[model samples]
Target: EADIYQTPRYLVIGTGKKITLECSQTMGHDKMYWYQQDPGMELHLIHYSYGVNSTEKGDLSSESTVSRIRTEHFPLTLESARPSHTSQYLCASTGLAQETQYFGPGTRLLVL
Candidate 1:
């Protein structure tokens, strides 16, 4: 099983605030993904990266930036948060040759 974790599992912030949702994995996986979802909604891929120093935008139109500085770390940052940005952010990682993704406990953000 992939050992992944997210910090600040629950957060409440005001709009226009800057926030970063951190995601880390113990497994040395090269592929990481970030997803966003609303209450009772499907997940939307926001960002993903295959390896260090590689970042890719997913299907969703997001205002978040992600960095892949290390194989086990992929953090998502929102420069200016909004009410619409309030949702659950999920982190997932998979091995280079593996298709099965192991997910971390999501961070739930509530922007006031």
Candidate 2:
């Protein structure tokens, strides 16, 4: 099975609150990615990292930030979340850019 996980599954919070969406993987893959997706819709890449100490922002410049210190952990944090930040955050990993990615269930954030 794919060794990835996301917590809360669902979140409902008022606007202008701090939130952190947890993402973890046990597969030890070096390439991790974060994507924002609307409910029952397509996904938009928001963050990605090549490996430890190497992180980069995705096509979407998000209010959220991510970190990669260990091989199997990458968590995203939003300093102050807003209603516009409401979306599902999906975590994925691949052995290589050309390889197939393993995705987690995702965290659904609903900023009120």
Top model number, lDDT: 1
Q: Give the poorly placed runs of model 2, Cα more than 4 Å off.
A: none
Poorest lDDT segment (10 consecutive residues) of candidate 2: 93-102
Q: Each candidate: RMSD to true structure?
A: 0.8, 1.3
TM-score of each: 0.97, 0.94
Q: lDDT by residue for model 1 over 1-112, one digit each (tens)?
A: 5599999899999999999899999889999999998989999999999999999999999999999898889999999999999899999999999989999989999999
lDDT of each: 0.94, 0.90
**How displaced is residue 4 in candidate 1, in Å?**
0.2
Give the winner by TM-score.
Answer: 1
Record all residue pairs in model 1 with backbone atoms less than 3 Å apart, i.e. clashing: none
* Count of backbone collisions in candidate 1: 0
